[model samples]
Target chain A: MATIGIILFTLVVTLAVMLGKCQKKPLSNACASFAFNTEMNNLQGYLLPQECEGYVAGYVNSGQYHSDFAVAIEAARTYLNTIEADQDGKDLIVLDIDETALSNMPYYVDHHYGVETFNGETWNAWVNNASAPALDAMLSLYTDFRAQNWSFAFITGRSKSQYNKTAQNLYDTGYTGWKTLVLRLPDEENLTADEYKSKHRKRLEEEGYRIKSCLGDQWSDCSGESAGKRTFKLPNPMYYIY
Target chain B: MATIGIILFTLVVTLAVMLGKCQKKPLSNACASFAFNTEMNNLQGYLLPQECEGYVAGYVNSGQYHSDFAVAIEAARTYLNTIEADQDGKDLIVLDIDETALSNMPYYVDHHYGVETFNGETWNAWVNNASAPALDAMLSLYTDFRAQNWSFAFITGRSKSQYNKTAQNLYDTGYTGWKTLVLRLPDEENLTADEYKSKHRKRLEEEGYRIKSCLGDQWSDCSGESAGKRTFKLPNPMYYIY
Candidate 1:
């Protein structure tokens, strides 16, 4: 009877182990766990397009994307009205370059959402093309902010060499009047986008500008000390940057 | 009769859910899910010292730490011999400070493995003390490398301000004769450790040094472009740096 009971326990344990494996998550035991379906979900709070290409593509290709941005615009308009800008303190909005202001959907679509790994050469080529379309929601928000007399600072992790192309791209996409355009210097290439952006915001503050709203798709955009009074995080589960 | 059957089924499901929660291993659904647990595990490989106080203390207090170091030394020696280094290409090893060469375990112990978050003032005080013990394994490996005529370059995320204290600590802890000590400049404070280290490694390459092996306790230590011929990652789950 004892032996039979032991045999039953073994069978149950084996079944449990098999069930665990079938849950469709990445195995953290291996070194290649980064960009795995599970790691992307845990760290980025969304699924990669590679994992569900159809769903993400469908969401972005449809009117649903427009609806989501509309809601964000509503919130931004309310916040902009709440704060009163005076001559003593110049009101400013800090914006991220990628995904937040511009859509890299074409690049992501070609690469399978980083499933094939991010190739720098190809990405640089895409940046040079400067054909990325404006995210309508962010573009709308930018117009509203401009109407309210708020100045803008565009901070990006793009290399300093790409400054001209990026500026042209923004202009072509209808970003008319940003007061400052901060690009990552070659020496500052080691800084994470978050760290790089935070420093730029601090520099603006030192120069006597008050950041009323900071907007980005990644948590790193709105995180760290000296963050603005309001932060709006748009949805981008497609990719994450440290 | 139908209501009673439905109640019984609900009770059984609840019991199963409770049992799943009580399991010893991490739940894929829970906060300590496999990927999060894996990230923590990868960072603090096999060391629960921060999360579980007594377990880490018990592991380090025992001869287990030394044994683990011995295993690492063995791996390093085998890899060192396997690679061919010549006079044409000066063989170099990149070393990271803090937990890679000298341990901050004492500080972690005092603070309960940073359960209270990293306090810079207290950590600076500890750095000022400069009494951190050398990892017997890494120290032994260093001696072996020196014997083989391979030069050493110490590149760390430590600020330039901490150079004197860090150098003193290394000397007191038995590290002697390194080619260069690269400290993070004040302007480079915003750079992620990985980016800073990668740039330093790249600079060394440009200056005609061939990095044979790079060792650190974090993935950022081994990742990015211009990484060494080989990378060795030591276990460090106490804290994470972006």
Candidate 2:
């Protein structure tokens, strides 16, 4: 009787779980709300005006604001392919790391308790905290570009020593799929972030990569907007370099 | 009051489900009883003899089988670095599709159901099905290798017409995150799968890729065997070529 009872219990439990999962309102959809800690921190128009040009409004109507980034990514892909490829047949899209590919808004809002800026030490601390999520538009853009054989390169102001940490952090933060993720190094030290970035972007082009497009919250990501390519901007009013 | 009641009911159900998940075994622990479906229709050493010896096993696991395939991926700084360069500056480890990186065992086993031989049309049906999981050891191997800077190149047996289907299937079935994926093309029709694969592999070598390792479940994957590179080998006893 005990053995029979055990079997019956298992059957009931399995069925219940499966049935629950199939239901439209599955139990505990509560934590579907479990977005990144930095998801909600982008108010105050801290993002720059040039980056702001990309916002077509109603970006987050589904409450996720998927389109703002989706349109941007699709627009970038359409525009990016025309750039000539070097011998290697790669189309490069330069991207920034912070609120660009990932959302640091929640950390700033909650952990720093409304602080609007960053330093290396604090930024490193947050990444090590490993609590961010890939921003929607960026994730979509990365996947779409990859599907089309275009490459997305992350050229960030994050210091060089944190390369592994940053990479691992990105993976942990659900930015796992991108392959060409580059970080800033101190040989990048004396150079302003923009200067180092411009040099590297040119190097990437010279090395046979057709850098078709550039995306970022910072001017440095676009080589300080000096490249001849067409640029699509996103609004990052929450934070920008003067 | 109704909303409060709903919340309370949800909390009770949540506790029950949490208990269930906690009691449930880890995904890793669920392997043994997991029945597989190999897509290939052959069960009686289904691959051709040379296909087994010279093609699948040879190039698929040629050279060193240590974690290099997974290790080399860690060196990828960006998609460009992953595709073009490496840390020690060697871009190696060209991966094979089918049983090398992904387990086609389940799909293969199904096509051979109640029989002990290989059949082509049934294999085609399975290819149409294109459902297989990345085996656990290989997944762990890949994740670890990607951490070690061993860049990966995926070459598969499905023809070019099957590229979109194959890639989507891989993405759906979890054989994803590869930087470079190549498909088998049946269009030319003049060359055998073996000759076709060898030429492509040679082309890569000619392009300056210092391939440190090759992996696949068929001899054609290691078409380098005649060249004496003797690529790595992994066991596939459930399906063999007579």
Candidate 3:
């Protein structure tokens, strides 16, 4: 019988790869979930203890982490109301550094990801395991957009010899207001760090400044031709890079 | 018949709550991945050109773009043998801007992962759909480490009001060399951007230079405290946050 139908198709593909590595969803399975904020905050079950410790119990037991933090706080309040309606000289917000700020998947499930076979001694033992925690209030609304003067940059993917261990793990995590860490020069040649953030935002829009909002966790940090000036998003289900 | 078996058990729990939106990948499958040096230069099995249509599917299909020139040539010869074993005087290699160099993930898969029902008309229709090509010999070795003198800094988490759309996305991608661009500080008290990159690597070890190496894609950019030095990881795997 064709070797018993190839041994029942190798036991149904090894039970579908052990059910996809035992998938997951038991933080008391409120039944996997549908969430888009569970019909805009109607939330019938759990997921709030600080977003169940910053999500991942199959997205808070299938709840989609409160509809993805209400769509990343409604895309950071529509990018702070389009940089407070930028009049042109003070209105900025561009952010995109590793999954849009912070969260490393417990260092890729404590070094299980391995990515592309890299090995700086098990990646310095997963950067000495500092442990991933923050995401709530995301550094106090980026320090209330630096008390509204509005200026923040972290644009990251990390290159140029990881500037002293990504600045000592963000100085041990406090994410102060922000200065301007852009990284990835490794030796440069006609720019590539997203075209040096689009020629440093066209030299701060010819030295006047209007950017008016751009955030990340990807989506081109504002979307192309070297993005920004009105885009905000944050809620990277986990790993990234495309 | 027991009310038709209780209406077939409420139609199998309403089809298991509408197929539970089938997850195991989808929040736009985190935007359908395909990177990690195009699957470690294997080009994820063919089909590229037309200026890399929908890109992120490289590893083999044809093979040409050598931006990360095979792990930046073994991480720039182990970053010039760790700055010629320390006594090499000037050793600067710090960077972190927009996903560790360049790559925004087609603006986060054109706004599907962010979700809150994505607005701004789907993020300006994915920024008028921009092109996403890069990795050119690791950006020509970051312009040969700024003509070999060796110095670069791009530190970012973007907050200082998106510094002109991150300097116009680094001048539309023709990035230039830099020394200072350390963001996060308008009463920065939340700190998480890797503790604001260990206070800008103690101001580059008090501007005495000799950083040796650091690079990223994650592991908090090689966690900090600056010991000896050497971190060159890449391959974001789409996203991470620990």
Task: State the lDDT of candidate 1 residue by residue for B179-210, as single tens digits.
Answer: 88899999999988878999999999889888
Highest DockQ among the candidates is held by which one? 1
Which runs in model 2 stand beyond 4 Å of their true positions?
Answer: A1-67, A81-87, A111-120, A173-179, A225-228, B1-242
C-alpha RMSD over true interface residues, model 3: 18.9
Off by over 4 Å in 3: A1-83, A86-197, A207-209, A215-242, B1-200, B207-209, B215-242
Query: Tell me, what's the RMSD of every candidate?
Result: 12.8, 21.6, 24.0
| TM-score of every model versus the real structure | 0.43, 0.35, 0.26
Pick the winner on lDDT between candidates 1 and 2.
1
Write out fnat for all predictions, comma-separated.
0.00, 0.00, 0.00
Find the candidate with the highest lDDT and give its number: 1
Candidate 1 interface RMSD (Å): 13.9
Q: What is the DockQ of candidate 1?
A: 0.03
Candidate 2, B49-156: lDDT as tens digits: 322332223222442222222322222222223343368634656666766666665664444322345666776676677676665555665666676766666766
If chain B of candidate 2 is superposed on the true chain B, what is its TM-score?
0.56
Q: Against the unseen true structure, what C-alpha lDDT does each candidate score?
A: 0.69, 0.52, 0.49
- For residue A171, model 2's alpha carbon misses the true position, in angstroms, by 3.2
Worst 10 residues of 1 chain A by lDDT: A27-36
Models sorted by lDDT, best on top: 1, 2, 3
